[model samples]
Target: MTATDPAMTALAHSWSALSLLHGRIEGSVERALQTEHRLSAREYSLLDVLSRQHDGEGGHLQMRQVADSVVLSQSATTRLVTRLEDRGLLSRYLCPTDRRGIYTDVTDDGLRLLEEARPTHNTALRKALDQAATEPVLAPLVRAVHQLQGDIPRPDDRP
Candidate 1:
């Protein structure tokens, strides 16, 4: 297809449109979570990942992996982990095989908080999904966005 084709134009416009939509939805979720639970989106994201990560010992996410997943620099991830650790929400352990690598594990307190906040987070997500359902095009759009993410280079890796 030619560059001037309508499909190509639509695809270009879709990129920007989806970006705006994604940011707005994420912002809404962040605000509500911070207001009610005192958790930043980044912290929530880290916890979410750690809660699901498999470490052969327990749930934990390597600091670098979490940093990459959340698009935070290593220093930023370290600071975030420090704050959470101070709050008794997370702990970091040096990897046995790699002394320099740190793995952040959610504390039991963190797990408790996560369990407690599930309702709140679910509510916000449900509200977003409900809003999207009003348009009927949103769920499929979200799936397409996930697909697109696979093709897009990560931000930190991009020039």
Candidate 2:
């Protein structure tokens, strides 16, 4: 495809904007998470999922379930879990019903860290959104992103 092609030009513009926006938002959140809680964004995501999965009593999620929720690859998820395990933030155990299945449970420390980091993460996100809203070219995309995020269902949404 030639650089002059309309379709190619449009695709390039869209991709470039997406890449830049992603980098900025991710970097801001990552920095906040790291500085405040010593957690990576992916780590925060894992903890958030684990916390939400908890039922009335203590609850746990299978390794595969976690891998599915996060953006990380399966191997990367496993490695992250191991790192959290080492830090005593979370624990891994075999599912009682399925001996081969590994389940991850967030420890009290993990929950505490998540709660502390929540404010920083939220602030970073709000700042990003506010910045995007001020940029005429990005405002529409920002709205579209929020709409899309709301449209996506969480695990509890399934029947």
Candidate 3:
């Protein structure tokens, strides 16, 4: 399609709007988390993801999985994990069954910080969404976001 095609223009506009929405939401949450907990959003996300792991079979995530979940490159995620580990907020250990694999877990301090920062993260997210919803270009995306959340069935709802 030509650069100026109507469909191409529409797609570009949609992508731009989506990017803007993401930037605004992330910026708001980042500021709130940093102010309240001295944590970057990426760090908080890593802590949160690692905290959900369990001793049950298949409960723990691999390093690559953690990277994918946090939307970071493997190297970047490793660096982030190392920083948190140095701060005593996380610990890393070799995988039990696979000597080549490693796993990271959140520490007690990380959990405490996550709990405290949860409210700030959530509040900042809500405020950002509410603000975005007021804009004509972003309102539909915001509604879609809420709709997608509602559409996901809870674990308890699985048959």
Candidate 4:
């Protein structure tokens, strides 16, 4: 109730502002991924990982690994891969050495989608980073966040 109280003087806006910003990011990425590539955020994330696959002789990351990386259950991962395979956007090749194992490969169609998504994705990311880069007060917080690898999802096309 004091006239000089910091709570009254200073803005109480961060939580709302940050939430709005995050919502915009989620909406923007969702729109771009779906309209431009006919992909959901999760499906686009899966393709993004596979696009990082090297040597095109077909790179296969274990389904379980991908699921854990993206915070999805094994069954969900299986279903996601199944959907992509149905669309000819992905393929599952048996791991030659492990009969019980399989890996997902991004198909040519998946690569095409990635090509469509890359520039838009990069521009969004760079714009966000550019804002972060300007905040000297946030530098330590950003570094601390970067150091946190405790099962956190990497910033991808996923929400």
Best by lDDT: 3
lDDT of 2 by residue, 1-159 (tens): 786999998888888877777777888899989998899999999999988875444466666677989977789999999999999998887877779877888899999999999888888876776687687767777788878756333325575
Model 1 spans with C-alpha error above 4 angstroms? 1-5, 55-60, 136-139, 142-159
TM-scores for all candidates: the values are: 0.74, 0.82, 0.92, 0.62
Winner on lDDT between 1 and 3 is: 3
Model 4: residue 36 alpha-carbon error in angstroms: 1.9
Candidate 2, superposed: residue stretches over 4 Å from native: 1-3, 55-60, 149-159
The segments of candidate 4 whose C-alpha lies over 4 angstroms from its true place after superposition are: 1-22, 54-59, 124-159
Q: Sort by TM-score, best first: what order?
A: 3, 2, 1, 4
Candidate 4 residue-wise lDDT, 1-159, digit = tens: 787777765443444444545555556666766776677777877788776766445455666678876668989988998998999999877777778877678899888877788776655544554455456644443454447753234457486
Q: What's the lDDT for candidate 2?
A: 0.82
Residue pairs of candidate 4 with colliding backbone atoms: none
Residue 140 accuracy (lDDT) in model 1: 66
Give the range of the ten consecutive residues with the poorest summed lDDT in model 2. Answer: 150-159
Stretches of candidate 3 off by over 4 Å are 151-159
TM-score for predicted model 2 compared with the true structure? 0.82
The candidate scoring highest on TM-score is: 3
Between candidates 3 and 4, the TM-score winner: 3
lDDT of each: 0.74, 0.82, 0.91, 0.68
Clash count list over all predictions: 0, 0, 0, 0
